[model samples]
Target: MRTREFLLQELHDLSQGIQGPFPYDDLRKMRETKRLTSHFKMLGDDDQLSADLNTYFMAIHGLASRLLTGNAEDAPTTAIHWLARGDFFAIFPMYCFLEDEWEQFPQFAHMYGSTKKMQEIVLSLLLTEDEL
Candidate 1:
């Protein structure tokens, strides 16, 4: 796993890079198949920053799906991937918000219970940040 400083620097570098009308078709396909490893592998380590951005994209997609559908099933499996990927560097806020709304998602109560430690880590991360 990357350090927080390294991940933050990568996010900053990605923010400075050329903005794209990026090709989403391949990514969308990979997402549908739940082939996240394949998707990340396609983005070689030479492009680590893009890989990081892709993880954030997945997290946002997860959050948006949950908010729109009000169903935990609608949440991206990638949410777990992002949680495992650097102690919730980019996905912390979304996870925290989702936890707050978890009461509306009784089906996910057991799963959420398993994630309590991650949620705590996310809270700590958020508290440590100068601004969220």
Candidate 2:
């Protein structure tokens, strides 16, 4: 498994390119997609996991909407806030891993040691984002 430091470093690297908030509509579509919800459900059978998943999705949607409609000056701050609170940074890599496209992004393959670890990270982020 990759060390936690490696994951943190990758996140830091990725964050450098984030200049503003993501499009609210795009995030909403991603969050509401049936495939993603089904994948989350398939990750676990527990109610806590399901609830966390829903809460996380809603949080992202809310954040995105707020940023989209709020002051332009607040975009960076809002983006950073949501980015820190959620696992949006890890989503694309996890999706690639789930879809067996890790080979297309060799760097992300080191983000998590295994598929199980990736799923756990996803769940953990979802459960914790609301707390932040």
Candidate 3:
């Protein structure tokens, strides 16, 4: 697991990159953003989880900005709506972990570890694993 400090830092950096208020006051605020939680934050912390979630959020946030400003590229912007739903489901595993669904992710001791890695694995599982 990454340390708590690292996770906080990454989130802080992510928030800074956002054009609007970041939804999270802390990671816990994800709870109020049900779709985000369900789709993204359930895995134990790891590099993959952190990277995947960051990428996902960056994509979402960028699309949101484009939509709000009327500057979106037609194809990418059009695709956001289609991807949004699956993005939520892809994020569910990590969200579960953040919510203290410990049994849901047994490999990591805490979320502070490699969050990006964890997210990546969960995303792969959610996206590619037919049985899931």
Which prediction has the highest TM-score against the true structure?
3
In the range 77-125, model 2's lDDT, one tens digit per residue, is 4433544543533533334324543233333333222322333332333
lDDT, model 2: 0.39
lDDT of residue 49 for candidate 1 = 33
Q: Lowest-scoring 10 consecutive residues by lDDT in candidate 2?
A: 107-116
Question: Best by lDDT, which number?
Answer: 3
Error of 2 at 12 (Å): 25
- Provide the TM-score for each candidate, comma-separated: 0.26, 0.26, 0.34
- For model 1, residues 34-66, the per-residue Cα lDDT tens digits are 435444356455334335445554453344334
True-structure RMSD for candidate 2: 12.4
* Rank by lDDT (best first): 3, 1, 2
Between candidates 2 and 3, the TM-score winner? 3
Decide which is better by lDDT, 1 or 2: 1
